[model samples]
Target: MQDRTILRTPLCDMLGCELPVLLAGMGGVARWELAAAVAQAGGFAMLGMVREDPALIEAEVTALRAATDRRFAVNLIPAATDPLLLDAQIGRCLDLGVDTFTFFWDVIPAVVRRIKQAGGLVLHQVGSAGAARMAEEAGADVLIAQGVEAGGHVHGRSGAFALAETLLAEAGVPVVVSGGISTGRGLAAALAAGAQGVQCGTAFLATAESFAHDYHKARVVAARGEETVLTDVFVLNWPMGAAVRVIGNSVTQGLGNRLLGHDPARLPREVIAEDGGTALMRFSTDSPMRHTTGNLEAMALYAGQGVGAIRDIVPAAQRLHLMADEAAACLARAAGSRA
Candidate 1:
């Protein structure tokens, strides 16, 4: 194998990680087990605790700390979550001594200030250059440029590489590219384009350690890039105009004509699924987790455009190592081409 050092970027030094791969803090799917596995493998990990109760956050953080001493981040969506809950979540993370926090959806300056005031590093995921600028002004330590091809809740309409290029042009801090990146070649491409790192969702979600259900993992493995669709059909728990990229399912397929412009209030309150006694209504933004039970096929099966590249479910550590090795090779080949 080529030297792993070739895959290291300045992001590794800033985040105190060995590789530039960052596990996407995917809500419901990215939990303690997956984060720990990635961190233990020398890549940065993130716990997806968006809008979760503080007790659960404590538990997940405790579990991750127990598994590994490596650095990891907690992801929270300030705009999507209630203000009071967001405060509590941030407070809980700070109390737990977490030094890194990642936010998505909207750039809340006050939240960023609060984290920064507490000496926590902030990584904001932005879909547009305007948002990226706003995040930087809000004191974000790093920026994650998410494109339309990203899975789950997408923020920017621009393609991944285009957004990264735009952000890297003026971003004072490191820029990590997200959306539709699931391979070592993708990582190499991001690095070649001057991105400091890559945030991956679909690739990591399909791993054996992910909290995603087996059915969801199977769908991602069997899916094609074109099989994924971006629609506002699943917007129950989030604000209006919030779009998500998910595998084509019966619910989405049924929206033959009306694929967008869905008003969550107008949607019928039909419980399509449940997790731990919580009723998951139809059109809910919640994805299928390991404990979720119901019409799994009709629920939101989130997957990026890169889902087609994923063929098997392996351990998170194994996946990270493979990607690192492949990226090292790809980088070496690019260097040779220039030589």
Candidate 2:
């Protein structure tokens, strides 16, 4: 396989595309427009189907279907509180004739079966190699190794680099790497580590199509290496999983004090819903007004170390194009040295 001309992947062949690189599904951020842009640009993109209403998803899916007749997937970040919501979302998406689905949170076997019945592909995300193997055994066609350096809630994994390397030989499925992957160089490194492609999140969130608030996009563009903090900081205000990454905010700042055996449940009750209402999601240009409010220092501002790779706000199409081009160049360089 290494000797083959680095072209579209088995996946791209499956999707009939020209590139293997994908835009990682950013919750709330992977809107229809952005998803279409990436797929149209020849990379598979996925819709972040967390916490979105059925009507909203329908409209977006319809729009995407019209925008570009390319293959893209939809993500369902499983959580308990709104597990039913996921069922509903999946039904609606399948109704829209969507065949590609990605599973996160906890994988649902029934859903996987349903997708397979529809002739769709299932890509599962994992934090470690063992989990990747499990996903493969569970009928997943691909494994996304998410490292600790990734943004959003670290629901599945703890170490990105280790997970990537571990999956190299152990995973029977085609492997993709996520977490802190923000550039063409990172893409090259991931492929060198035995990845078939790369999934980038923070890098996409900084693009012009990203629905992040003006301030949020600016923050990403202006971020330095140490600007991000990973902890259960947003967990207090939100009922999200125990692990998450966000800009160091008051909730995280107070974690040390609360860590000394003081029950966070004993602490004050200022926040309301803890379910998916406040879960960390990527911002999209088409997001509801709820996401537009620049309520920094409180809301979830998920980012990654790759924020430094972002400098300017460009179109999503342009961004995916450049990443693919750079990845091709990098792969060519590696292939040339093999002889």
Candidate 3:
């Protein structure tokens, strides 16, 4: 069973899902289990397929297919190295029957052409209206306007709703607002402002199927609106420039700009490992995984402003259903008010 009440939007119809809510393709966090759970719950789920091994990516996709027949998207992080790596990944994904994709960072013309040729739907995550226009011209099917308040590596300085408003007026394709959005009220506000849907990342981090560590999840649950800091303090995993929003940990509080002085830490170095032996970076773009060892408390706890509203870890389906029902009721009340 999907959402008990269907709240239809262009995003839901375009994605063939019952609700307009989409699980942001969080690297390492949105694994097969979480993605499958969200998809099964009537929300469109996306797997972060950017930095995974080829075999592992294929295996994850196969596992998700085995779990649910629902269509989900794979998010690609463009590589600066050999284009062959990305081509191989895309080919493997197409072979596995995946049709939708989301791209972050720069837009690769060849990739856009290839996916379009294969009849795949392309959604681009852009921080600004300029990038949105560029992706639309490059044949992107949807645009995710991510605001600065979003967790992880957020690109733009503008807020999500503000970015969405500009994109909706000009981007031409469907626009989904991301960042600082977790509640039905947020969803209604996005829709009321002309957005097609909302892409939630931090909210799903508290779900039972999420791979986030208990300690990390607890931090998110306890976080207030002012507790998160968007900084470049954690730079062990990715490049040095990107700014990510994280809960104020000791590491973030003590080290102001020290990450700028340190080089990106080498992965597979056995610094930290989450439950089930999943290795994590010293300051990972992904959140802390379960049963993690080695400086767990000091490690980066990625979350968004919406963490204020998250209280407990629940099933992803139940969260989606409740949010959908709430959004439906909110929209109904809003319409009646205008009447």
TM-score of each: 0.99, 0.85, 0.91
Tell me the deviation in Å of residue 215 in model 1.
Answer: 0.5
lDDT string for model 1 (1-339, tens) is 668898788899999999999999999788999999999999999999988999999999999999999999999999999999998999989999999999999899999999999998999999999999999999999999999999999988999999999999999999999999998999999999999999999999999999999999999999999999999989998998899999999999999977789998898999989999999988989888999999999899999999988999999988888888999999998899999
Model 3 lDDT per residue over 1-339, tens place: 324343678778789897889999887788999999999988999997766777888999999999999889998877332467777888888988789998887667678878999999999999999888888888999999999889888778899988888998897789999999888888878877888889999999889999878888888888896888887756655665667888888867776655334445432244554545666655656556665576787677888898898888899988888788778778788778999
Name the regions of candidate 2 deviating beyond 4 angstroms.
Answer: 1-7, 156-158, 236-241, 256-291
Which candidate's lDDT is highest?
Answer: 1
Q: For residue 231, what is the lDDT in candidate 2?
A: 64
Tens digits of per-residue lDDT for model 2, 2-67: 222364666567655676677777767888877887888777888876667878889888888889
Candidate 2 structure lDDT: 0.70
Judged by lDDT relative to the true structure, which candidate is superior, 1 or 2? Answer: 1
For model 3, give the 10-residue run with minimal summed lDDT.
Answer: 259-268
TM accuracy, model 2: 0.85
